[model samples]
Target: MTSLWQARSHLFNDRTAGDYHRRLAEGLRRVRDRISRVDRPFTGITPTQLAARIGRVDLDRPLGGAAAALDELEELYLRDAVYFHHPRYLAHLNCPVAIPALLGELLLSSINSSLDTWDQSAGATFIERRLIAWTAARIGFGRGADGVFTSGGTQSNLQALLLAREEAAHVSEPRVLTGAAGHFSVQKAAKLLGLGPESVVVVETGGDRRMRTDALAAELERYGGAVIAVVATAGTTDFGTIDPLPEIADQCALSGVRLHVDAAYGCGLLVSPTRRHLLDGIERADSVTVDYHKSFFQPVSCSALITRKGGDLRHSAFHADYLNPARVAAHLPDQVNKSIQTTRRFDALKLWLTLRIMGADAVGLLFDEVVERASQTWELLADDPRFEVAARSALSTVVFRFLPDEPELADQANRYARKALSASGAAVIAGTRVDGREFLKFTLLNPETTIEDVADVLDLIAEHAARYAALILEEPHVPA
Candidate 1:
């Protein structure tokens, strides 16, 4: 007689349902325990050491069951995985996902619905379309506007630029224009579109870290009919600086240039009660990108590229008999017709569930709280004697450097401080170069992170910087 585990002909059958539930329950228990007692956000291991430890896992052999496999994962990955939910993990744009979104994840995985066509995903198609409509309305688009969920802001931007490229194909040698501090993907999109690296003309930024409309006007005139699209950043990655959208929109309108707003980072302001006004002229854009994962507290891959005119999406559509054929797709609204991706996951469900449970205002309040926290942190750092801070944050990032006695040692001290913080695993923050000098950044996305937590991290950074400075002074230089 066969064993009970081997008795089932296929997975997910009635016989295996109990086993699946058991595994899921066990996994959740482990996660709860880990989250409750996790003191460090990271394991603080060297890359080489981590690689050696992970190498011990044999992928060729079967782990026998989910219990065994999960145990191995816990040891090899979970213990070392960066936890964004932690109060001290202020490294990047990663946000702690809402509980409702996790429920959506579970439902999507269980159903495995692909939102390419109506047949493959009947209700899923309508669900995603409803979300698109909701988001487009939030952007103040007219009824003619349409959008599709994308993998992230990068893909959304690519789609927006691709549409712009197609619309401008009538003009010879059309070029893309964006702010100097715009996301790197705009340049990447230009290159990917077969426009050479030089095809993107960067407009200079002003003292306020916003796009200089005067310089933009000059460039537009210089390019004349050669400019296709003017890309405006709603929120910059490093500084969380929002470009002057109202001014940029006026310039784009006057120049007859198609405007594309990359609001991937600041799109959450749509619901943010305190800062939504910062997105003033985004409504006038011909196209826009929004990443729910970044600020909406949704899971990864929840982003959309929206366009004012529905016809603009035609550039990305392709028909095949096996998939979304033109005839069938015309009869019913198929998401694949508007997206660059086919067989896309039901990521919209996560946002849908999030909205249904938490309401949009609550989500906005969470973001508002974090932005407030960033303000508090900026105040603390600016008042502290150890840091030389930059301009006040427009969103939720604080960029500053360690103040050393010697100006020459400032860059090295900042870099060393960042490395030491990461190696110690007390907290993880980001670093960037500002005007050729290194600066540490606090990308505060976690609402749970208190001002006290930020102060402690700052203290650690100062201690580390001081130690490095002393070591550098101790080094004797040989006469050349």
Candidate 2:
């Protein structure tokens, strides 16, 4: 024990700088090699198989060296890990992260800055505040706008609804209005806020998957004084459809209801050179949620909840004598006052480095590329007779299903195709139920993915689906 204390090889400090540098370099090199060698998004390994491999590890014994540990990790984890950067990975909202943001991630992890207070984080507090102000300005908010970084879209939505709930404390019974296509997080947030299960009223959406202003107006009038807030989605997850923001804002204003725009997916449009007008009415929102990890190419857990009036964030504020005391709250820049979390990571640094190194336009262009790719994908699906598309998206998702010779077998065919494609590791895609029928979805967030890749995946899906349908048909019919 005395020798161990004297060595101090494990701790990160001035004395262990060399050890830290060497270990980190070894780890990075192994990751870089693995990424470069990856040819597919997944290895088709089942959960049980991976679990057995992990379970066999002897936790009591240590590798004792970085190289040996990395070698073990490569086989146990890196060899079968899903590579989101692969062009064939057309799955969820995950994006191929930016290199600059990776650098920020490295620096922040090493420094280990806690962003809850000024004394803990120092300059990091101001950096986060500046980024918040910059994002608010992009949303067309005035100097009174303010916000704090959050973990992701779910937390941002929760914080926004929390503020809205507190603002309507005077109302006897308050209802939250949102589109049928809005995110499920809104419902979860309502539950966490101690509201009744029926507190959230889902307004019907039109054929285009947008919340119909007429339906919204009717709901507003029906609820009348009970309606406390209207939550509008800038981008629906399944259809990638955006609600009619200008009309929704108008209705909310007239009804004296606070408007919270959940733009977690569509916030990328704020910097889109060619399509910023899609969010024209977002400036009128009382609060907005932005997820930088989704469309901005930043790493996971980088998101914010910006409010038009900075004071609205006071709902989340609670002073602790040991941390942010009430006496010095005015003088110190304590971010915990406006955040739902304490001891938050310095996530803002990732976006800060991304902006400083590559600028916002470059990130926007990457998103534009994916959006264009999705359009091309839609055209491909629309022209193909083997598939039936649900609806064209305004963003980077295309929802469609493979149609079999027998219409009744369409759902099974599509479902089998999705599972087969994923299991083969040739490609990865998402699935969802539309109108009570199964459909496959392609969320094109990787700019590197091309039309040819999508076309090849389509052919594979058709093959798998056709095989499944054929197998079913070959089964002998038994008399009931």
Candidate 3:
């Protein structure tokens, strides 16, 4: 009789190919079945329940075969997974990935290419460089621009800030300035770089929630030479607001401050047919971060950190003997030379394949459609008396709160409604605290998501808020 290890062998040998194909086919079928069966984005289970269910699996002994393990995964994991592809998943920056990118992911994983050095990656090195070059041109960075693929928006921002930090090493006290609405990562990056939290000065924003140029100028003047980089947000998180980039760029130029635009959320507009002009002055920045995963409809971990000057990438370079050996590093294009990561995934293939098959204009059109949908959804909310909608969206998010009859209960009502709606699993959305008040947010990333979907979610929100408000009114309150 054959032993268990012999019967179920690994991938190093010949027989594994047929077994791999069979298992992968089964997995694909299960994915299709899950997509068809699950109409909701979530399974309405609490975090504690999910943890307990998954914790029951014993790791001591093997399940004995691939089919059994896959079956177990389907029951414990896939059934409750948050499905971004679900039309009702209007929660966050998550997007429905393109089919071409998925296909590229499949190929890249099977090949298992590591993109650190030239010999290791070979054609993959050039492929990534090509994508970076193409993206730099899209931003109109011109001839001298250079960039490297990163894990996501967070990592890309960190790398951009790292470059900015190195360039300012000559200054005695280096600092960074950004708008109040900028991503939290800005502060985190500053701290990690040994600049201390105080080094990040938060400039105020206007009523529309965009960085006030006057305020930013004042801060720059106050800091003077201490401010090494002026960070401008192309797309803010809560309100989807964009700063006046052209104006900010002018200020940076006058002061000789290094400019870095965080366009992770709005990078999709780079290809937009009508909205491309919104990103004006982006090319003027010293550095920029673009997250393809967020707005390019690629899978997760697809982002790039680009610089206006190719030579600026040297700030992040350090030679490794085992990896990018000195002998060959001079001649070939080793990706690790300019990147913060080693053993990076070949994620650039996803966008390359996407562009080859679907074309850039097609992806841009999808983004345009969703942004247009957001405008229509905003009108639906603005016209309704039940909600107090925030300012018109600059991208694809609408932030608003449910208004009950009692003014004091508005915050409580909105928070309660979001929780109740999530538990029902009819639809899923995100929540945020704007100006110390709770509000519900609709982040429309799917072009297929319609205004009718927004209306349905709004109706559910109102119903839940009304029920919660009634319960609050019926309760007896004791004075503190």
Candidate 4:
């Protein structure tokens, strides 16, 4: 077995430029042929059908359940199964990863490094910390800052909020003050931190989709209980709106509140010379969250929770004698201490390889390209009078709706339009209700996405809207 493994390693290491070029050609052919026309998700076939095609992947009969159950895995069930790489796929915040990052993933998986301990990871631990340090330095934390990579933005946000919870003494269910337009994960993180539903104070926002600092100040003054932290959205989930971080930072500083910035959307801009200005007040934040997957274009699961305070991860730090012995390099970081998951994958490897190859500016430029695509989308929509934009903030998500004659049916129309499109297997788009008005969202996180593609989707939207409107009119027997 050892000889076989060593031989396999040798073959893998022998992956040359020519081999990669050949593989890329195969990938391009598969993607172009299978995904070009597919706008909507493809889930018609079951896992059993897929297995049949692969000729029976035997379940419970092989190593680590490797051959286990391919009988029902639905590729379309998961967001990733859908073709995010398709030019027309303007549905989610997911980005098609850099080719090099995928290669890095392959390398790391083959090595199978467990990040929980230094004995398992060794050089990998330092690489992860180095990447964290690089990210931390950009946030102005310098020597005082430290961080840990997480599975994605959700985990990163959760970790930052937990740090705040610890600061709040875990007493009386600490309250979290956040913008009304904050990411869904903020409330989830609050709940996970034991803040509960009642503890979350969804503060009103200013014109920029940021929580009004004045409103937060008022909430702080009136609230009797200890405020755990003020969570600001550096990049909102839906509208891509950036909260007023500087102003929020001032409030948190004055009120002695821990400020956690969820910059998962906008963090990539920190590397952009042109757009880094969006994160002005992030320096004042006690902790900040960033997702390398979204705009950084690393892969599916590269996220980090960074802090200006070195010991902020205290709450997450574990004390298993078997895992963490104080005698073993008191400064050594065991991944188990800072992350929510144990037996975590070596996600940092791709990130390390990414930053190493692309450099920070190249990575930042990738985000810059996406932002530019978003601007182009704005221009595309501006030309058409049939569509009404809900809002177009600085980040990638653009919310708009078709204007039907009956405003009353606007919500239903918006929801159904998206449903009909996805059901047809033609294209996939995102939808959300804004101020009771349902709207379709164009979330452009992919750098490969073009203005023409967005235009194509908008045209499809108009066509779908008209079709649905005609249906509403024709189905006279049913109440509108």
Candidate 5:
């Protein structure tokens, strides 16, 4: 018994105390080396090669023993992982979080607290509650408002549609209506909530990306009670457009239908006093989805679903014998009852620490600044001779392309060029089809990125454009 106790103590003790400093120091040095090496304005690993390096080996040994097959972890996977924290990374909705949040992650995993209940989680539950309540207030949810942090926009939307699904069961199949600007996750949520792809109908909107109230009314009238709920986009991914949520809210109120706002992207601006007008009707939403990773500058895996009523989550409550013992005992709070997940990470801790170190308003200023930079870039791209800017600025992402005048060759050339461009080790931006034409996209989520960085990206795209033009010229001329 004494030997067993000693063994267990050693297992949980500082297993790497002697080497922790060394490993961290080496990693920091390597990071410094990488940062000094970059001269371009964008970077991310190629998807195909990154996929090839991904290797997982489950440590099924059961008693704190680590993987026996991870010798390649550092050399193959860790070092080559996509460097989003790089100053040049302006390619996606990903953000470089505050270092405090990263430190919070270390403390959280060490404590390993589960925020499912006020009992098991103790202080952890309060931490989550404080963050949720604070986030709700930012969205103008009144004193009694509440919410839960989820995995991502997809899961938050799943929970949003799930609430509508359980409440409006009387509505027939093919029962959901959403703006064309809404994220694809709403449709996925519909399918998971018992309505398939056929059930989710897209209501057309104008170029401004606001849902047409007339179109929504016509569809609702034609379909009658077949519609269970209506979804509006707070920030659309395609063109960084904000669909008119206030109009959709009014329509839902008139129609007596549920309103779910996929505010995953735009919700971050709630803290930004200057940019908060973009999500004018957020408080009116029956449910709202926000991603902390996008705007609040938290690590990935930090998203949330906020509802008008805290009790609305009963729609998904379930009693699992082993998973949710609190449900069986009837004396403890079960987070699984509120969310579609169990064994959830203490993601709330990072958000809490961030709010403490930097007030929500400061984060709001960051949002406003990024949007202002995007506007600055929008004008810059318009004046540049080598590129074209498409769409009005809604949030941070600016869609543009190379060789604006060569529209006839734009489509075919972009498809082939970006494919080769990413394979090389220069700048990396995304490609999007705007009004059926391909344009390079620099999605500005990083507050560290600058308008000058946008100029660097344009230079890279122009260089690639010359090469792409030569490659196209080499192809045999074909008669249309």
Candidate 6:
């Protein structure tokens, strides 16, 4: 029993501090080696192949040491992992995290602090509150503004809608109105809130992919007093287009409807030296969702939901005797009361460290670089006859597709090109359907990505698309 207890030196404590230091150093070294050696965004390893490799590992048998465990992890994860840090990784909304944030991640993981209550987290709770206040101030919210960090924009949107539902409890039917191009989470939130399938009404968008204010006004009049909230998207997923916030705010104000802005993708503009005016009317939003992971170059799962009125957060509050009883609510700063999650990680540390070390302007400059690159990419696509570009984004996404001579073959060609590009592991891009037609997307979040990289990826896409089109043309045709 003494020997068995001695062998288990993995627990982190004063006695095992040396062991923890050694293990952590080894893990960081392995990760640094992998990041330095990664050449492409992906290895194109199929799910079946990787699954089989992972299945061979014996979970019951211990590797006995950190080095051996890391060796196994490299084969199972690090080696074939999608390297978002690579400049060619243009797919999705993932960003190459800031170094300061990475440093915070190390400390937060080691400390393992929970932000549920004052006693549990102490000074950590105040840090989170201070950060929330800073974000609210950037959005032009007053002293009554309050917010809580969340897992991501999805949870932020969910909580915002929950508050809106509670506020509209007097109505028999409450509807959520948003742009047709808004994030799908709004619909999901409505469903999760027990609002029926038809509770969400999508307002039509104009040629620029922004919600038409005329249509929104009409919808508001059509719904009469039943509309609960108007969700204005500051940045859309595909086009990165921002809705007409000023006009939307006007309509919502006149109709006495609560306004929620899902700026998950556009919140970076809050500190943007040049483009801050694009989100001019965002100050009028009753609630706003911001994803620091998406736009602030922080690690994953750093997001917050801010409200103009602090009391609105009570909609998600539930008291438990042992955790946070109502008797101590006024005396103690308990974060769990404002959050849907009970035991949440201290993700606020990452952003806190990021802001402390790099400052908001520095982070905004990184985003500005990417946005500039995206504009140049749009011009490249618009001038090239081989492709048809979508609306020019005010943010950092470009939606376009290869245009072949035969209109019917355009969809198949673009689809094949996206798959081939991913399979070849040259560069990564995203695909989406626009108006029932297939299209490719470039979500440029990496500041290191340049026009040269964009040009190269475009050439690769064109080559793959042309090859697919030719192959389709050569195939033997059959009469229907």
Note the clash tally of each candidate: 0, 0, 0, 3, 1, 0
Per-residue lDDT of candidate 3, residues 194-295 (tens digit): 888789999999888999999999998899999899999988877888899999999999999999999999999999989999999998999899999989
What is the Cα-based lDDT of residue 72 in candidate 3? Answer: 91
TM-score of each: 0.96, 0.97, 0.97, 0.85, 0.87, 0.98
lDDT per prediction?
Answer: 0.89, 0.92, 0.89, 0.77, 0.75, 0.93
Between candidates 1 and 5, the one scoring higher on lDDT is 1
lDDT of 5 at 25: 54
Q: Put down candidate 6 lDDT per residue, 1-480, tens digits, no spaces.
A: 336686666668899999888888899899988898888899988899999999998988778777888998999999899988999999999999999999999998889999988888998999999999999999999999999999999999999999999999998888999999999999999999999889999999999999999999999999988999999999999999999999899999999999999999999999898899999999999999999999999999899999999999998888798888777777989899999999988999999999999999999899899999999999999999999999899999999999987788888889999999998999999999999999999999999998999999999999998888787888824110
| Model 2 clashing residue pairs (backbone) | none
Cα lDDT of model 5 by residue, 41-153, tens digit: 34335667666655334444333422322334554554555566665566778877777687678678767887665556777877787788887887878877777889899
Which portions of model 1 show Cα errors greater than 4 Å?
1-10, 476-480
Clash count, predicted structure 5 = 1
CA shift of 37, model 4, Å: 9.1
Q: What is every candidate's alpha-carbon RMSD to the true fold?
A: 2.5, 2.1, 2.0, 5.1, 4.2, 1.9
* Candidate 2 lDDT by residue in tens digits, 373-471: 999999999999999998789999999999989887788888888888888999999999887889999999999998999999999999998888887
Candidate 6 has an lDDT of 0.93
The residue-by-residue lDDT of candidate 4 on 1-480, one tens digit each, is 346754453343445546545554564565555555464554434457655654654544443321122213323223226677666667888887887788788778768888888988989888888888888889888697888888877888888887877777746757788889988888887777667788889899865666787888899887745788888888787788888778888878788888888888899888996999889989888898988888778777888889898787777887888988988748776777877777777888897778778887888887888888887787777777887885676878888888877666666667777876775656678988788668889888777777877877777777777777777888844322
Name the regions of candidate 5 deviating beyond 4 angstroms.
1-10, 14-74, 321-332, 404-406, 477-480
Error of 1 at 253 (Å): 0.9
Ranking by lDDT: 6, 2, 3, 1, 4, 5
The deviation in Å at residue 20 for candidate 2 is: 0.9
The candidate that wins on lDDT is: 6
